[model samples]
Target: MSLVNQQIQLVSRPMGEPTHDNFKLVEVPVPELQDGQVLVKHLWLSLDPYMRGRMNDGKSYAQPQPLDEVMIGGTAGEVVASKHPDYAPGDPVVGMGGWQLYSVVDGGQRGMMRKVDTTHVPLSHYLGAVGMPGVTAWVGLNHIIAPKAGETMVISAATGAVGSAFGALAKARGCRAVGIAGGPEKCAYAVNELGFDACIDYKAHPDLKSLSKALKDACPDGVDGYFENVGGMIMDAVMLRMNAFGRIAVCGMIAGYNGQPLPMANPALILVSRLKVQGFIVSEHMELWPAALKELGTLVGTGKLRPRESIAEGLAAAPEAFFGLLKGRNFGKQLVKLA
Candidate 1:
């Protein structure tokens, strides 16, 4: 049977915030499978903040998402056709399959595709809780912050993919997990659903002074550790509440992902608090993935780690979903359901 693949390609690099005009949908005929190849029908596509940085034409942690190409993304899917001995039709897998309906995967390709066990952990989880976002939270908290029992840890963008996992993991480890989110609903969900100790609605507290006051109230003992997903003012507030010898993991700067340049409020806080702040890309730390994935997978499978998602219905909704993600419109993990 002949298969046609539908894909969304990066047609233009966005100046600041991305829009529908930056992408183009294209259809192509799937080629015949080679001896060591398989065709996967993508079921879910992960839309994340990191892709925003990839959309820009500049130097950063990774290479820019090239123009006129399939936009970078993670996908979970089922093998529809296989010529390789190891994979059979209907095998569930997850990989960096980009924004497409089907992905051509090579058996010889080591990291791009991996068969995932969905009996305990759902296949969609390979893109979120049991996937990169989960690993990111684990590495940042375990390696960088290293929060101990009874310590207070703050997370910004607290209801999104990385922060939600971070909050739940922190709580699991016996730390006081406090969150900073955009709206009251997200704030309530962070505390009520994610079990965060407290959640501050940044929208209600718009200015630096107001947010700092809220943070001080939330972290009465001061912030012993911080999982930074949003930078700018939220970060500034957290810094002010940092305890002596505090630790910080700079996971992302979502607040400044757009073209805006947000300067740090207090550069001297690092020295004053004797803070340890480290920035990392989870992909670089491949050694820790096995351990992290094991723990995260178990937590997700057992219902200990409850991660939420904002799923878009089709491949065409990718751009709009991603746009909302950048603006903190997404409730948890933003995903596109391709099938």
Candidate 2:
């Protein structure tokens, strides 16, 4: 079997917003599988906001994506060849296949690669709702923001992969899930399609006072929990409306990801409201994945969690698609289809 692997590598680090110059796409021969390795032909590559953080060389929870190496990403694909006893060719699998059309993974690694059943759920959902993003939403909501029924839970980036999944999980726990998205279209989808109680178009309310008023109107009982995605003004607005003993799960700060300053407008509110704000990296909680995946997969299989995808056609489109995701240009989960 002869196969050439197409891959994208990070050639440079971005000072501000990433430019195309930072990435270089090239081709290489797919390495022959050894004793315990498996060859995976990536079908769907996930583009997420966390990847932006990995692009920077600065120290973080996870190691920075090395220069000249495959750009880091999650991929859902099918095994093309396997020397591992646990895997076989044609098995649907999920792993960190990176920005490439193919991957050679060591099946012996504890959590590096695993086979998946795509009968009830689509293979792509494993990269979004039933994969990392959905689990992120679950971990933050359950472990951090632990909301009670009848409490108001708000999430920014409402129509995004994590927020959409969070909306479903929050609703399942009987909390009033409110959403904050960038446009009228996203807001409409968040409310009508994703089943949020109300969704505020943050674009319409661009400033603190305006956004705070909108949040107040949508959440009449005050915000008992917040799943933060975008930071700065939206967070400031939420801070003003947070109830005593409120919880905040700080997920992504996309607003400041491009080197923008993201100072909270009111630090005193934290003390006054006595809010429990926690920032988490979901990878650290590997033990909870089975439970999270079980709930998320069930949600998708049962048609309760309807995840939308804005798919880019091929491996080359990943860069542009990721840029669109950072700019709020894509709807729902952003994925790249290699085949």
Candidate 3:
């Protein structure tokens, strides 16, 4: 084994869009494991929109990523060395190992490092569809949307990890799923491949008026529930189309994550439509993870949920890949293949 461990660190905070200078890749000596600790060699690293919030020093659901420390993220890997009795060498596990080639984790905490069964679902799925993103979709849908048959549900960032999984889950539950993606290709994939009833290309209709018209056209019955991912003009358009008593699960506001604060322009719509808007963090609801993951895993295992991924080749590509994700350049879940 190599003596050095390569990792990415946050060198600076981004003012708006993150630049290459914000990250620094460095190599460090691998630390020796202590009692009840295990060493893992990461195979995959997940780059998510939520990580952007962690970069800033402002208050958030999670703490900011300390400078010069490894960037925070989810990773899937095999235990290469073990001092913990429960974890043997070659055991497959997934956890929040951050942006590194190897991770040293305590077995007791392990970042919830449960063993994975790759015989059915691939190890990578444990990082995407069957992982946090997938469970997030489940939580929002089951707990928030609670859709009935024939209900029209719309989601923004429809080609992303959370949106794609949410769309599939809604479809399986007999609801009509409409998606809003950045490009035509992504929109097409959402409808044709992921089984979304319809998808609107936000890029094609740049203005709020045009996007609202497109959404109205796509969901003629009016939006019964909304899975919000980007809270900008897209959200304003959705707000205009929401039916009375509509429920919205405010999962993310990536449009304003960098520095812009795009507050809702249509607060009156919430009152006029009598909508119920709730924002939640998936990690806060660990009690529902077992049931949610079981359902998400079953869907993924049987091919019912077709989760797509846009994978970068190595850890060096992680920062660039994440930048692309912020600009809606990626087609699906953004991931880094470290191994």
Candidate 4:
């Protein structure tokens, strides 16, 4: 067993917004692995916007990250030592390994970890499209939003991991996919690179009313499905233009993640349109992941699904990168690469 572990912890609960002081990077001794436990050296760490909710001290679908505890996250790493027969040295796997260079994981806590064939696809891809983000998109689209062929679909945070995956899946299913991103570059990437039917730049079009009009114009058929990643005004705008019997999959609320309080939506519109909105955490839908992963992997391997990742070079840059993600500064799947 190792004597030291370098890790990041939550120093203070953020109020309006998180600052650098909210996180503290500290080195402590690694705990010894017990029977049926394995030690993993993390290679790739995923940074998703939903993590913001876990920082707050409140009851939600999942437990909040406790103050002064290691920040929780998903990571891809190789087992270095194992008392668990299921995992062994050099086996690449992914699970809830928190924000650390190394972790001692109990066998029971490991869910999705399996030896991977990195020769076929990059190991990091397991943390993105073929992993949580992909499953999030799949379940939201298929089970929740349920977009029909030739219907109009729109997604907020369109250049991000989950949002982009949603847009691509919508397009693949014969729906017209429209994306709302932060900037022109991201908009361009959404349409040109990601093959979205159209894209709206939220930064360029600051007026929610105008944005709503543009979205309505883009989808003359009316928005049949909305994959909501960024909430707040975007939700308001989309709700105004939603067609009858529209479905909304509430995947994230990145717009309010940086400490802003979300305004109440107009309930009248929901009543009038009979909109079906369902919020879900990926952890709750773990039962569907194996099937979702197989489908997503097929799409990626066959070139039907494309994932764009915004990678930060070192573990030290994760905090800044995460802050950028909350501000819509990242272009794709935000990840911190560990050496």
Candidate 5:
């Protein structure tokens, strides 16, 4: 059966903050599924900060989206029709499907579209806690930072998907986890709900030096591991308190993603403290996904790991959700429900 699909395309690249004019929503006919291909009806479309980088026409860890292309994203969907034997109709899977109502993907491209059992948790969790963001937190923390018992770890963007997972995992590993968020509500959620030992409000504490002092006060033991998310002043603040032989896992720089000029880096601190600061993309640690999923799923199933999702209904709201994510308006995982 032929299907009508609506997709949001990048109309223009933004200089700093992206406005609605940068996106154009268009309706088109869904392409026919080819051999070793499947037609998926997207259920949940994730709006992550990393998407901000893709909107620009620049070289980065991933390829930039060409002008007028459907915006790239991770999507959870059900297979409506399958030309491939590995996937059949009604199979729920997750993969790099664009922001559209329907998508057709070949078997090779659909390798990331692993079939999921929705009975275990809500299908949305697969896009959040059990998905890329969750895996990012797990792999980066476990493999890179490797926080030990009694160590102190600090995570920026602490209420969002990856940051939330980092805080929870750090606490589970017997380390003191401190979260840094934009507002009081998110800070409360990070501390009370996510079980972070303390949460700092960057908005409230605008001065990086003061924020560093506050963070150091909360983490009297010194910051052993830093999960760097928003990498502007917050990063500089956290760097001030890095303990000797500290490890920094640079997951993202949401603070600089909106075409901002790169800030001056202070290599002196790294040199003085002998800090091991490394940047990584989730794709680099795909081999460890099985282990991450098992641990994250078990934590969620046992009520230890809690995911808070800010879900926007309909594909039309996706652009707004994307804007909200960049502005720190999202409470947790920002998602658009397309199905």
Candidate 6:
């Protein structure tokens, strides 16, 4: 007899926006481990904005998650059984285990799985602040933007996993962090909880002119750096506020995922503005994660980076939770608690 595992699979590619009908929940028997494999029982599943791009069968940085397969996702769980020498039962590890209750990893594959320390930081934080999202912030701020002290840095989706981490990381470098979120509550959290200098509610400003003015008021000295997550009008608005020679790290342009992408506005002329813009995929730069993870873990352990989480109760709730994530319905890191 084998373990029966519950998992979510993407049944169809989304046309405009994804719906519940696009996903299928099914149970399958966990496969027997090969000589070099280990079995992991997932405890948490991470749902991110990037997953949206993976759902479409289009040209992108990474391949489509693959139809009829387990919906791809990051997971933090314990190795329940192991045939590999490096991993033993009870080892806490993190990997791309998809949306499943169990995962079998070929321990021979490097970077496929990593054993993490949950003594200081909770295992769940590894999915958000202390994990990929945290590293994204570090890479963008340190590697690309590299803002100087007293400079102002603005980020869209400011209360999200990446945005929240970006604020604390920028502040550590003595940069004034400003965030633009959808509503007043999110703005308040960005300022008060995330330690951002100020936050602008994009919802309050319906048009591009209003959003730009709000950014102008929030960042009086002009924006020295921008960590772009939500693009489109947000990018246009932020572009108008960018100072000459400012740096922009385009991590996600989710504003264009479901439909036709938004065209850049006139203010985004890098030649005249002399702005340095770079779009990056963090997975491609694995060499930086060691240093980035160290700093993020310290921030959380020291109570400096208090990452908030919104956890859906079970595996079945992942799809709905993910939809909420794309719609800006979840605050902080969106996750599904599996076990």
Can you write out model 4's per-residue Cα lDDT over 1-339, one digit (the tens) per residue?
456777889989888678889999999887888998888899999998888888988877788898888899999989998999888899888887888888888866647456666665678888888889989999999999887899999999888888767877888899999998888898998898788999988776677888888787777788899989988888898999899999999988877776678885687898899999999877788889889888778777777777888889877788899888888778788899986
Q: Candidate 1, which segments miss by more than 4 Å at Cα? A: none
**For residues 75-166, could you state the per-residue lDDT of candidate 3 as single tens digits?**
99999999999999999999999999998899998345888889899999899999999999999998998999999999999988898899
The Cα local distance difference test for each model comes to 0.91, 0.94, 0.92, 0.85, 0.89, 0.93
Output the lDDT of residue 332, model 2.
92
Supply the global lDDT for candidate 5: 0.89
lDDT of 5 by residue, 1-339 (tens): 578999999989987899899999999998877898888899999999888888787788888888888998999999999999889999998888889988887866635588887776778888898889999999889999998899998999999999888887998999999999988999999988899999999998888778888887888988999999888889988988998899999989988887676574576999899999999998877789999988888878777889899999999999888988898999999999997
Looking at model 6, the pairs that clash are none
Lowest summed lDDT across 10 adjacent residues in model 4 is found at: 108-117
Tens digits of per-residue lDDT, candidate 2, 3-57, equal 9999999999999999899999999999888999999999999999988989888
- Which ranges in model 3 have alpha carbons more than 4 Å from their true place? none
TM-score each candidate.
0.98, 0.99, 0.97, 0.95, 0.96, 0.98
Q: Where does candidate 2 stray beyond 4 Å? A: none
Q: Which candidate should be chosen as best, given TM-score against the real structure?
A: 2
CA-RMSD of model 4: 1.6
**Index of the highest-lDDT prediction:** 2
The segments of candidate 4 whose C-alpha lies over 4 angstroms from its true place after superposition are 1-3, 108-112
Residue 60 CA displacement from its true place in model 2, Å: 1.4
What is the RMSD of candidate 6?
1.0
lDDT of 6 at 132: 97
Please report how far candidate 3 places residue 125 from its true position, in Å.
1.2
Clashes of each: 0, 0, 0, 0, 0, 0
Candidate 3, which ten residues in sequence have the lowest lDDT sum? 108-117
